[model samples]
Target: MKLIVNAIPFAGLETGITRYVRCLYQALGAELGVQVGYLGYHGLQPTMPQAADPDLWSRQTKRFWGLPQPLIAAINATQRLRLERLLRAGCRSVQPRIYHETDLIPPPRLPLPRVYTIHDLSLVNHRHLHPKERLWLFDLFFERRIRQVDHVITVSEFVRREIIRDLGLEPRRVTAIHEAPSARFFPRPAAEVGAMRRRMELPEDYILFVGTQEPRKNLPLLIRALALVKQPTALVLAGWSGWGDQAWRQLLEPLRLEQRVYTTGYVDEETLADLYSGARVTVYPSLYEGFGLPVLEAMACGSPVIAARAASLPEVAGDAAWLVDPQDPRDLAEALQGLLADPERRRDFAEAGKKRAARFSWQRCARETLRVFERVAARKQARRS
Candidate 1:
């Protein structure tokens, strides 16, 4: 079946959504060949800004938000208009059987069946957690625009339920297609892991937390919990800094954990795999997530995971990782201590996690997603008849 997708996300930084689109299309292309088409701006793949240097991180944050609010809004409007024009022209040429909106923003009304992928309703559900501009955009456009689509696809069942309950979408109109860790995330050899650890200047034994350092990630709680752990293990924050208050650093000084924590800026997937393989245990105590990918990634890389028992994390981690209350530092600390103290338990968890991670694959996601597209297209054709 012929398909067209919104390529707007490719114009920005490499985020979870960007990765989702890239992986899904790669798998889809392998099966469908030239049936897939992309519309909108396609710039050079955006790289994550390195944050190993504090000053560089600060400058990048300032450069992003330094623009006047009114100017930023105008730019956003112009970009959207250009994207819509591109979509209109591309649709005429490609004559696609289905249109998939990978980004939340909907395209102009199209004759063909349209499917939208809503990663989460965080802007509506957790407004306090997002930036002001994001809230304004969601309030003004997203809720209304989302209703115009024929079908909604979510990254997790929890998010699907949220979209159904909160947005009042019909259960039959929405589907949940789980995402998978890339093939690159696998058990790395000990020698490679050792060399990577040395090259990155990471501690001999460290607890790994992979993701952008933002308030939503609950890094402060992880830092506090680290202080409480009995072992003198180091904590490594592997991803770059995202937009949010840098309160996690403030806590480190007061808690006397300044030296115990290390930030590796942003590393590539290969380095991430090695880091995960070398980690004593990977922890992702985020406040909420539509789908907790790092938990699966860590498990796939032969590391035991400890994730929050909130939102979709339990669903993602399944029975493999230790689930803990995200808000309670003491509870998370106890779990960390218990897990670190037990070698046999960690090994068992690693095996169980690998098995759990294996159940999800990009090929499977593409197939399931394709079924939705076909169903939507068939129904449209039936209605036309």
Candidate 2:
């Protein structure tokens, strides 16, 4: 079967969705006796498995979503139209057994069996957390065309339910395939963890939060919670910048967490694994998530995790993690302080987390996803027959 994934996300920024598309495709491409192709570049030329990582993408992704006010909206419109035309033209020529879009937007009027991955309803349901440009684009392109998608893949059952509720799609049209921690995230040897921590110049003991600095992450609440914790540990954040730099500054300034908080910009996968393995406890206080990859990553690294109980987080974390209310800073602080006060409890959670993380794998995600594509392809074939 010729399975072509619209891997254009890998050709752009190294965001969570990009990582999702790349990792799933990498696993799928490795299968024998199947011709797996990628549409990473504008030409829709077959994607190289080696180029799945965004580091290898030739062009530095132009950050347009969060820009200064003076830039003309016309330029953004022009760019969107041009990209749509180029992608549509390039993709239409490569007729495959099935075409899968990793992101929300589907290809324009391509008469092929198509599958779309819906990460979350955050854009559709919680538009206030995002910028106007993003909301505008999604409203224009994604909302209408998404219904035309032949099938849908969601990261969690919560998202699958949300899709049925929000999109009014038939339940059978969507499948929930759990995303996994990458191969790089796992229990690292103590020596290697120490060496990497030293190389990164990280504090010996600190709370860890792995996510972009954004409003959706509820970082300000976490920051306030950290301030209230009487424990002597620092807070280490490992992620790229999103849209809340000013908000972050205001929160940190008033709290005066200059000595207690450390914010490291985008670290490589190896470093991220090390940071996860090194933390006293990893925290994920996001208000919502489609799947909450970092929570699983921390678990895979054998790190004790404390995540929010909202949305898909509890679904992902399951019984293995300490769940906290994301909205209440007081509740988050109590949980952090309580966990830190008991090392024995942290150790117990660590062991449980590792066991839980073992249940999910990229290979499994690929297999399930491939099954969905093949199911639809067979239907399309039977219709023609």
Candidate 2 lDDT by residue in tens digits, 1-385: 7766766665555658878977887787776345666664355556543434444332232355435533534565566566556556655665678878776565556667888888999998898888676666566677678778889999999999999998999998999999988888888888988897788787789899988777899888888999899987999988766665457667777888878888887777888888898888999999889999999899999899999999999999989999999889999999899889999999999999998898999899989988998999999889989
Q: For each candidate, give its TM-score against the true structure.
A: 0.93, 0.92
Best by TM-score: 1
lDDT on C-alpha atoms for all candidate structures: 0.84, 0.81
lDDT of 1 by residue, 252-354 (tens): 8889998999998777788999999999899999998999888999999999999999999988888999999999999999989988999998999999999
TM-score of 2: 0.92
The residue ranges of model 1 lying beyond 4 angstroms of the native Cα positions read 42-62
Minimum summed lDDT over a 10-residue window in model 1 is located at: 43-52
Model 2's alpha-carbon lDDT is 0.81
